[model samples]
Target: MIREKSKERLVISEFFKPFLRILQIFSCYSPVPASSTAYKMYSVVEVTLLIFVPCFLKTVDVLQSFTELDEALATLLIYVTFFIYTLKSISLITQKDDVRKLVRCLDLDIFQPRNTRQRNFIKGQILTSKGILTLFTAGGCFTCTLLDLQPLLINRQERNGPINFWYPVVNTTKSPAYEIAYAYESIVSITHAFTHCVLDAINIICMAFIIGQLHSIEDTLINLRSYAEKEVNIKGEPNTTEKIHVQMNILLIECVSKHRALRRFANDLNKIYTNNFFLILANCMLALAFLMYKMSKAATLDFTFIFMIFYFGTMMTLVFMCNWYGNEIIYKSGNLHTAAYSMDWPGTPISFQKNLLFTIIHLQVPIKLYALNFFLLCLESYISVVKTSWSYFVMLTTVSNN
Candidate 1:
């Protein structure tokens, strides 16, 4: 038991590593379940689960769904998960914890963080604030504006019904609840995406800072070596070599620090897209809502939007997910317990071919998932154009058949 406690203490020294271990234990194998309270990182792991549980249980019409520990419990879990993460945030601000200081100690002080960290920090702020805004937006303006979602909501029971493969349109006359829910989910997703992106940016920034610092230290060492070479005539070759060897341990320390950063960066990115792919999930939900609405009419405009959403969403999801592989490998190489930059895609081993798809995901994984909110604006462009364009000019909304 003493040895076990010491082992636990050693592992818990890292900030987020403990939380990751908990996750591994929770999902992998363990008897009687582990304490959910045993977390250190402010990850959305809990939030993601919460978002799913309550909704899933509510749909199944089971009261015990709230109590059960299964994947089917969606909404309840979603609530619980978010609640936990929020609790962590609150704790971080309120506690006497020293994790941040510990991280500072562990961090390489040689390099400087990239702009990515600031950007990510900003994004996190936006998510925290804008997600709240999104929540309100999903609730609608509430100006006593009554909307009929029936025109847009799709009936899921239809068999062999024409489904749109392009852009999706939803009627706001009937399926208001689902639409509202979907919109709210979008807010949750975007917020989460922003959070993850911000975290990545922070990691990058920290890494850049560390690496920069290390570079300077390396330069100093090189200068010292040069000086030592010049002094070899006086100190003798053996004495000069001895002095160089004396600084060897410091060099080794710097090298280790550099290598670990690279490896951690890669591993973190490889898993990034999947961990925070909620934005795509939100988009997919929006597409579903649009599909729900399009089913009531034979119009192609609605179907086009559906197709566009699916096509774009799927492609984007695939791109984001697959990009992680290259990122992981590159970072791994950079942090390879040695000082070397990674330069290959699907690199080093042929076996990584299977992981090539993931590498692509890593490569394209943007630090800010919502940096292209303009595209989101474009998505909504269909709502206005399709509804009003026919009376104005050459109706492009009527051009394609979904």
Candidate 2:
């Protein structure tokens, strides 16, 4: 058991090395115990001061900007984004144990590929996850850079910080205060981007892994008969038929067990992230709406236009990925019943046939992830989000014109 556990840890660590490194840097994942002072201090500094405080001030600014429609919308975008950052940070800190449980729940024994073919599939999925994460991080940094440089693009007299924060005591409109505020906002803003990327990476990568496992199960079921035949042929026993039936039963049982484990993992994931998903969907809708309206008013070559473009594109990708993986899970799991039916069970023993029937019935319903039990995280929800954003944008434009 110890050896098996050690191997599991090793495999998981190697698989997630890149993501884990970035997560640690942001204090989202720590090697040390969560109860340790060092870990607590690091998390506090990274999350409380950097995320919560800024988000609070940004919320204040969002309320204050209400008097001016354009200003309010602009500040509201940042506020929405920062709100997500704050929620993500707080969740990470407060639900430390739950997060750990989620991580460990990806039991290597269940997820690890048994064959070279499955191994190659898993490898490709890992590479794809890493590539997506890298792109997300790079894009986030690039967006932050564009935002931090926004004030520089304008005249010095009109200069302001990237964030429209309502500082408690400091008069940030003056020369030195303005510069200080700009620097602080830039740092926090960049950190927010990184935190966003890291959390999304964790969720999306997990979903990717689940999708890969589902594919492996499907493949196994589809090829179950051939696999059993090969095993029987290799043995060359007197009771070849009985051996084949036994082998089929064994493989079928393993697949059923793995599938159930995958379902449990998916449920745990939904519990951990459903609230966050609700917030993300809500925020993205408002942000994308206002961003579109604002971009329409700005000159094509202006800094504001360019900045909104980057921000808009980033949000689109984030929303798309969340829904895409979710939809993939549903689609893949939905195919499991078909795969089981495809298994050449016609000639098998009545016992084997009965087991296959049970498995098929169990897999009838496709697996799904949801937001507050209202929004199913799939392409359909993606379309709904986009449409809602468009409606909000239209409303804003009408209100502004009046």
TM-score of each: 0.30, 0.93
Q: In model 2, how many backbone clashes occur?
A: 0
The list of candidate 1 runs beyond 4 A from truth reads 1-54, 57-249, 257-402
Highest TM-score, which number?
A: 2
Model 2, range 1-402, lDDT digits (tens) per residue? 001111222254465657667767777776545357876788778766787788788888887788989888888878888887777766765665776777776655777665666656656776797797778788887898888888888765776788768988888888798888999999988878877887777778878888888988997899897777766665665547778889899889889998999999999888888877777788789889989999988999788788888888888888888898999999999999999999888889999999999999999988899987668999999999999999999999999999
Query: What lDDT would each prediction earn against the true structure?
Result: 0.32, 0.81
Q: lDDT, candidate 1, residue 149?
A: 23
In candidate 1 the C-alpha lDDT for residue 84 amounts to 35
Worst 10 residues of 1 by lDDT: 1-10
Model 1 alpha-carbon miss at residue 304, Å: 4.0
lDDT, candidate 1, 346-389, per-residue tens: 12233333343333333232221211232221233333323332
